[model samples]
Target: MGQANNKTVLLPLAFALGLAGLAFLPAVHGNPKTFAAFLGVSAALSAWDALLFVSTRRGGRTLSVDVALKKQHYLQACVQGSLMAYWGYYWPPVYAFAPFILAQLVFAYAFDMLLVWSRRDVYTLGFAPFPVVVSINLFLWFKPDWFYLQFLIVALGLAAKELIRWNRDGRRTHIFNPSSFPLAVVSVFLLAAGKSDITWGQSIATTQFYPPNMYLVLFLLGMPGQFLFGVTTMTMSAVVSTYVFGRLYFAATGIYFFYDSYIPISVFLGMHLLFNDPATSPRTELGRIIYGSLYGLSAVWLYQLLGSAGMPTFYDKLLQVPLLNLSAKWIDRVAGQWFTLGRSLTARQRNLAYMSIWAVIFAGMSATQGVGDSHPGQWLPFWRQACEDGRAYACPYLADLETSFCDRGSGWACNEAGLLHIALSRSGEDLRRADPAGAAVPLRRGCELGFATACQNLNTLTSGTGSFARAQPTIEDLPIILRGSKGEIRERDPSALYALACHEGWPDTCGRSPLTANSLP
Candidate 1:
């Protein structure tokens, strides 16, 4: 009886942990709406689990097939519908999340049909959908807008299925039991609250969503609960047997990679793309891009190495132990030896190595035409002309001096040129030659490339010169402008805030405003 209870519990716990991993993916992509949806679904699922518990306890008997099937279908449909509604509310234009909902429903129906055709029991039919849901949730995390809704639907389905099993059986006795339900509930609330805070544009310092301190608090708070739960769920005899089995499994097989390599790389790429640009300074951009690329490449390389080695075998799964410690230690030893060898090179050899490195660097720069030409803002025809002529380096100085530098490939030059055009429009120097439409191209590109200063400059030019009269600030642009203002204000500057206030139709400066003052803090 004790062993049977253990099996039932471990299954749900494993499913819940997998769902928690799915919940984190939205936060990874910085999608507040999706993150919120993930939280909501988690909460709803947890509530469903509670409902199942009450039902089973009250009945004092295993759940009937009719009760379980109805609950599962209802939960799946409700979750799918809620996610669709969220997507429609937050991201209607993209219409990206619609397909995921349809796919899930179709897959669920197909699984049901297959079960019927094979003459399997309803419980077996329900279990068949678990792996499919897990795989879909894993795939959906790579997309920013699609992740939250997909995860919520799939996770809710899994939770409902597990609850049904527990309802039919008195108590779980698996490696991943439902005893961790309390922790799962806590995670749901934390994730949901974090997402809600982000959506309302609340400050992170005040919000627990991504705060460093909150993570520490959660870690400490959950440790005791985990320990107590583990103790109560499994007996000492079972624990000993499992430990021995785990050791044997570790000896027989190696570690498995359940998570995908591309997910992390995609996440890094998305973050770097969002944060990279001129606003951060060229030095910061260089460091960020290099570091991001290196991390992505390293992850991919490790995945390839692991896949070639055939890790995470049946023995590892049966024992429930990771098997990669030995390989990791061996790799570390080899790396240390290689680093020591590198440090032992003679001065003459180092000099030759440095020369070769410089040659390669120069060749790469020549091939890519340096940062000036390749940067998004530097793609103007004039800047390209200058870069092609080998005079692109002078563009920034020329822009600062308000002179039309002939360097066509310089981002600084394009920015200056655009500003000049805006200034000319205001001064009535070139009404016939002024290209207000053309001016937005460089300004927007510069803004997107992390030039918060450039965004501030563009805000000034557009709002001041009447170019932005008909345009409304996009939801995406509001956060960028707000971030830019905070950066400017930190430097004891108020220009970005002033622009934002003016854009919002404030008569006075940002700091002096009655309505806007509250937004600053």
Candidate 2:
């Protein structure tokens, strides 16, 4: 490849890295080594394509080189999609996720082919559907039990691409990006159905690595695509608007709107890759600004509203894109109107209108502001029920409730909290702050309340001399500690044998025999 091709890829790639550096550099937290590892790997993966795109070009300015470049794009998509699926498969929650990913990809590819075979012309060797399916599936991997629901999402998203379109600028264009549309619609449904109460852990946290290596790779690989579309303006506008809006929101509400930092890596991907879908977004300059601003504002509003209502904030940022996509025609017309009007009016008047519109929107948002749930205690019952119904993911949340209750001086709750902490710690995450002697704080608290089991557990943890892991309790211990002393018996209960009954209504004679016994308590 020549200098021109290098510039095309390199410039946007540099711009993306620069923005990431600005966001992450100032407020450094977490392990730098982890972040560095992610950054380096992502850069390498991204550069692999860049090098290929550069090296595989035909000799000189020929028509076939353009065709070859197009093929490179498709190859890049395939390579990236394969790599992403492999990563998802190999990532934590391993086996359960990989099969679903393969299933979705196969379904998406076949669906796209059927559309093409019927003369609908939406097939691209799985390029379009592959990324959409894999990325969404990867994000939704946290809730593996909801396989049927995930399948529905993939089907609906593909169906939307074929079915939903509008006549725009003398050509029919899909109203929404396939994945974005389905994600937005499903997010709303999930919130309404109370499904959002379940934990849909962020993409990064779901990964085995600390710094979210998968997302970092995605952000890098996605940069060239964003550049190819020349929608960097939209990405910039959306990111900047979100940053400013978050600050203003925090100032007014005293609550952090997004993450601890405004522009986390996740936010960067949401802005650039998800929100800036060139096919669905507006083409004109003013339209891009309005579209991006609307997205940023709508995201913040939806996040606050849904999060206040006790729904997960995982999909809040991505939900508004499809909603906004529906208004592309109107937005294009408005941008055109602005362009014409700007030629007639003074620059000051244009600026005034911009400020005035934003002011009104912000003012309305402020007036309708809701006080989000300050106390997570209120959601304990619902979370508990969800946890009970085979949703093992709810353990972390139940632990949170017990922790909160224990903090309020409930001795039993303290014990429960200690047990949960130990359970979680045994499973790879140590919620307890004390290292080596995990769960000691809660156990000590319970012990002070005359809880014998808590004291014993605390002793086990601190001493670090138990064959049975101190972080977890035995089954027999649960019966003794949880059931109290009322059912105490020196002998083990034997399997009962029924004898002949004299009357229908009479209780039958039962026989019991104990074979073996061991010292327990």
Q: Which is the leading candidate under TM-score?
A: 2
Provide TM-scores for the models: 0.24, 0.51
Q: Candidate 2, residues 295-330: lDDT per residue as tens digits?
A: 767767776786666567666566788878888778
The CA lDDT of each predicted structure is 0.33, 0.52
On residues 310-397, what C-alpha lDDT tens digit does candidate 1 reach at each position?
Answer: 4311111111111121122233344444344334675445434533543454345335422111222211223333433444232332
Best by lDDT: 2
After superposition, the stretches of candidate 1 with alpha carbons farther than 4 Å from their true spots are 1-80, 112-480, 483-521
Candidate 2, pairs of clashing residues: none
Per candidate, the number of residue pairs that clash is: 30, 0
Model 1, position 485, has a per-residue lDDT of: 8
